[model samples]
Target: MDPRYFFFILFTLPTLLFGQINENGIKGYFSFDICEAVDTTDVIFSDYGGGVSGNIIRQAGAMNCVMDCSIRGNSFSMNGLDEQIVFFSGFQSVFNTSDFSIGFYFRPDPGVTKMNLFTKAEMCADSASFTIDYNPSSNQIEATLAQNSSIRTKVTGKLDPDRCWQHVTFVRDDRNSILYINGEQADLATASTRINAKNSSVLVLGSNLCIDRFRGLIDEIAIYDRAINANDVDDLFFHPEEIINRDTTIFLGGSVQIALSKNCADSYQWSPNAEINDATVAEPLISPTATATYQVDMISSDCTAKDEIMITVLDPDDLDCTEVFFPKAFTPNSDNLNDFFRINNPYTIDELISFEILDRWGSRVFFTDNPFEGWDGNFDGQVVNPGVLLYRVRFVCKGVEQTQVGSLTLIR
Candidate 1:
């Protein structure tokens, strides 16, 4: 066995070191590969700390096991029927803690109906018990942390079988007791005190007593005395080595391209439906006139993951739109150009406070509050005689208000 194949096998992603103990404070590790363990009972399950050697026992009979190297190199396979693996009176103090983390990778077979993944309890009572289990009916992984049986914090998302080969981690600390799936935090909340498995005389995996046998491949199971951060679990989930955040800044009317990585996801959905060039593709061009947050949901065969990028559109503050070239001609005859006495390029302006046109006698012939709209050679649905029109305009620029007076001729 090569020294680099420690922890069953090293699964690297783009030059990243996976399963580093000093980085995460790992205490107990179970890589169920017979070729990796030095001392074992019939070369079955071995611990990273060389302690699975003493915690081996059989309840009904020995479970027929096999080595599978398809996922992350190698894993222990179980038949979800009458197979059981019991542990002696060990692994008690390893789990007794107020803050701890348990992480592993597993793929469940269809025969696995309902079973607890990891636990150290005497019976059905939930007090000194810490366990993480799967519920087929809900299609979710639930965590019970030193629970009272009735109250447990749980986070659920649909786990289709195609996405079954996933990494899972559970943690309980002073601030939060969280469950992470595929490096994404999963538990929704059922909090309890520190676990009390110190006096538990029996411990087990795959199944308990006579039933609840798991049918799947499990690899790189670990127990830590301290809580690990989301990044640690993310590495366990085979997350990309680089931070996925693609946040950027842009001036008003400026656009940027954002893209998603193509590692394992099959489909994606982006939100708000604003100024995206192509919403269905892995990359899209966005040009927002205002600051906006864009959300994208990535769906794989087994799980759904989400991420977001905020586009900080440059503020239109301090922008001056006070200049308007009032045409000195007329033509409501509708030839399109210079047809109405209007402000040139009103679209460049942010807001129009007031715009009014008066006759020579100071009588208001046309009144408007829109910069784009102007007098169409009409006063109250009546065509006024062609003459010089007096106008007053007030507009806002960068939150500042300014006024301008101008005159124009209206031609028929």
Candidate 2:
């Protein structure tokens, strides 16, 4: 094999790398192709007849497998009923390597279902060994290594399969094995079934014993001759096309235009039911009637990404209507200019304290008992003539007394 292919297989076979050791210590590592496939019929090792299907494909001149499977159903399962349907490549020689590592890339279909893919022995006997399995019943992926028959280290969680393709790696030093998901250290298992496999014993995949076979696809199986590090596992998932960074927002109208970080997907779907259908463009203009949260699912030929935003429609009639104040001055005259004294009030007043119009002679000309009633240059049922009128007013505001004094010009 070419040197580049060998390096590719060494780095990209496991999803994660852990327990990296130097010349002084023991180190473990692993990786796999999330989109590639492995064919067991061609290899000379134990053949459980496990093959690849669905989005599984081959990369040219690369030693890893890549899976392009879509996330539709609740579970991604491999039919292990037929022994050779799905299995690993080399389980017999798992312990022969003094320092070893393993990793693989996977995108579990949404929902619940468990599957097993690989296992290894420490010495020559299979009595005590390590195993990695996915439990669909519990929505957890777990790894078990032999520390003792009584106690072992195991890590499990409900990982959202819809998020993205994730790399899972586990590394075993002499004393302990560390689990890692997506380049991050996970829980550790100290007391595990210690591996005891003989040298030259073939490594096995797809089956734990004669049963417990894997019910999913496998690809890019690789066993490093030496231990590797976490950085090595991260490289498998660092494809330039897999990183998606886009800013998505929603306005009153259902219009979305997001610039993606990479170019792999060509279609998008907005949530909250858009007015127009069949609009699969990356940035589609849509209008939703009610206020709602919207999410966009971007689909590539091989993978999918999604984001969400919220939309809220406001009522147009929600306006401001407050009291408007006009200067307490007006010239009421027959000249057709400022013919009336009025107060521009937009709100209803609760009370009228006092309203009085006084002439220049310092005598009251008019007064009002109603807050809405304004002086029309009239007093005692008689129209007052043109002159300068002084008005003194007092009113109660919020139970507090307030007063104002102004003059009005009446010319008629």
Q: Say which candidate scores most in TM-score.
A: 1
lDDT of 2 by residue, 1-412 (tens): 1111111122211222322322222212222312232443111111111121111112233322222342211112333543322222433444532445566545543434455555654342334556677676775568765434554455554544444445566666554666676556766655434444333323444444533556544432334444556666554333322223233333344444333333235676656555635446555544555555656666755456666555454332332222324345566555556656755441233345677778888888777756556676777778877767787766654456666677766655
Which residue pairs overlap in candidate 1's backbone? Answer: 152-190, 153-189, 153-190, 155-188, 163-302
**lDDT of all predictions:** 0.61, 0.47
TM-score of each: 0.48, 0.44
Candidate 2, lDDT over the whole model: 0.47
Off by over 4 Å in 2: 1-78, 83-97, 107-113, 121-126, 191-201, 208-211, 220-222, 239-243, 246-268, 272-294, 298-412
lDDT of 1 by residue, 1-412 (tens): 1111112222222223244434446555655544433443233433354233233332233333445332344566655554434444334565665567778877666543676676666666556566667767667887665545554444454554435466788876654578887778866453554434444545566555323756666676766667788767765664421115578766687997775543334676677767998776566777887889987766555455566788877655544475756877778987676667778757556788888888999999887888778778887788899888788888877678888898878777
lDDT of 1: 0.61
Off by over 4 Å in 1: 1-24, 34-41, 44-47, 50-69, 87-90, 147-162, 188-199, 209-211, 239-412
